[model samples]
Target: MSDFNSKHEKVAAKLRNEITGTEYEPGDQLPSEKRLCDYFKVSRVTVRHALQTLENERLIYRKQGLGAFVADTTLNSGLVQLTDFSEDMKKAGLKSSSGLISLDKVEPIKEVNEILQLRPDMKLIRIDRIRFANGNPVAFDITWLPPGYGQLLFDEDLTTQTIYDVLEDKYEIPIQGGSYRITAKNADDYIAKHLGIAPESAVLEIDRCSRTTGNKKVYFQKRYYNPSHVSYVLELSRNDNESMSSKDGLPLKEFSPSFAK
Candidate 1:
């Protein structure tokens, strides 16, 4: 029932199934390009693309001079702390900078109301900027602020400084807990141009809503990151004395067993 337009996707899906079903186990060599072409009755380009799709998913890996092989399945990062963007870059030894794209006071939109608990007529200061690491555009951030905070953006140079720093130093906004959701998306024309990637290229989009001790939502931000450049990592440990593996064979190492002695 699949259509012609989804030919590549269909092939990719089938290839993924084969990988999951152990048609090719970890460390097992994949068939050569010509062999894959013959088996799938597809062109070399199609086969290569299928493999590339798997590579991106970390389901398979290519070894130099050796054929592609199934990757050792492992759990990715877990959700934990809400780290500051500028601090993360600094720790990575990357020269981080921000360029102000726009700053305006606008009436809170419907989505803003839900995220920030804004009143019906409340206004907000919205800032859009490009965050650079090592002078290369890595993220496009649009940050929203509740009213009065608009003053902070005007007196401080948000372009060359960390927003978190400005918030703490000038506005006295306490660094409190926040929540974030991350997912993969394709870049649109605007994002593509800004990030220097082709339209529809893969991107990791993070939606974050931060609040203070009083639960006052001060910042709601949308960050679009280039997956090829940066990866988000979270460290966790296991606490339960259960067996190491689950019914699905996933490890039970969810929390660290020991604290600092």
Candidate 2:
């Protein structure tokens, strides 16, 4: 490798470590290239390469002429990526856990029934969990699945693994695709109790449904997040003919299809 390439690699590794260590908070502006050059005593090429490396890793994002900033924890879930909570946490260098509250077979609720298109007489597997990031509770999740799928899940340990892992690896059911909707919700007594947040607090809620490649519904999930600790992001690409743009300083189509939260 060339000397410049080696320097860039070193610089990138340095920044990557700092970002993972939380030296910079999410959305915080990073030092400018000029400043980075002065600090590292490197050339502009090296600094630019380092910034690009971080951007590519999604640890930082650049705004043209404005410089780069630490990327938010908000998951910018790609439309097609089927990622689970543990995988998402691993990428961010954090340990994840699920506090399994309950796993029972019960009559389907209205929401789960409609989302999963389940027959009224069929029972649903109701699993409740508190998802943690770095050992801190981030989301209170309740998921309902079809009996066949849910039964397969009972053999696995939910506390130590994500359902996605159990389904795909154990049952050989891959979560090929999914859709989600994000909306704000008030924390009720139940949510507050599990999430350890104040009742009536504002929380970000996501309703997600996943299916197999064959179009069979796999799971219907309701997740509530403490907005301060967790966030969501969406990345969009413009076609060759269309210019990229945002609405009112916010990105258009504010949805991350994957359950990155």
Tell me the whole-model lDDT of each prediction, alpha carbons only: 0.71, 0.77
Per-residue lDDT of model 2, residues 1-261, tens digit only? 445556777899998898888698888898989999999898876687677657656688889889999986455422334467787778667788999999999986876887888887788999999999877888899899999888988878899978876765454454656887889999999999999999999999988899874689999999898887866666664433223334323323333322333
TM-score of each: 0.60, 0.62
Candidate 2 Cα errors over 4 Å, as ranges: 1-80, 242-261
Worst-scoring 10-residue span by lDDT in model 2: 248-257
Off by over 4 Å in 1: 1-79, 241-261
In model 2, state the lDDT of residue 169. 49
Among these predictions, the greatest TM-score belongs to 2
